[model samples]
Target: MAHTIREKNKLLARVKRIKGQLDAVERALEAEAECEKVMHLLVSARAAMTGLTAEVVEDHVRTHLVDTELFPDALREDGVEELLAVIRTYMK
Candidate 1:
């Protein structure tokens, strides 16, 4: 989205870090690492992904659904509800 252009670098950096975390998990698996260590890596990677999802969702809400100047009140409400429904499904 055009709104994301301003935050592209920041988003890419987060993605890169998440990639590294996943790589670490993969390496740990290949090395037959301890269960506890592997679990920690997996958890870290999952948290990073969750954080990235939250950032993108928040940006979308602010840029698209929350701007009264660009979107009417009823449309914004519907858009927000739809987004919330998606987030609920995602969190599950």
Candidate 2:
């Protein structure tokens, strides 16, 4: 939630691009464009959505679950960084 405010514009821009893709898909259907073209639009929109999902999840992890100032070696040296790395790999 905290990161959302700081990254609001970037997130909104992504949403706008996604809206544009949806509009394109609707128009393509209305015009009865080739299936290939419509499918491309759908694919693009899906990929954009996936990227947005990953980014928000990453921000949530960093904002809510991570503590920057301390890492107990018993917990794993640099545990926060290690957790973040695992999250990044898993999200992808």
Candidate 1 on 1-92: residue-level lDDT in tens? 54478889988999999999989989999999998999999898898888788767766776665555665454556667787778857753
Each model's TM-score, in the order given?
Answer: 0.69, 0.73
Candidate 2 lDDT by residue in tens digits, 1-92: 46778999999999999999999999999999999999999998998988898788767766655454464223334775787678768655
**lDDT of model 2 at residue 10?**
91
**Pairs clashing within candidate 1:** none
Choose the strongest candidate by lDDT: 2
Candidate number of the best TM-score: 2
RMSD of each: 4.1, 3.8
Candidate 1 ranges with C-alpha deviation above 4 Å: 1-3, 66-92
TM-score of 2: 0.73
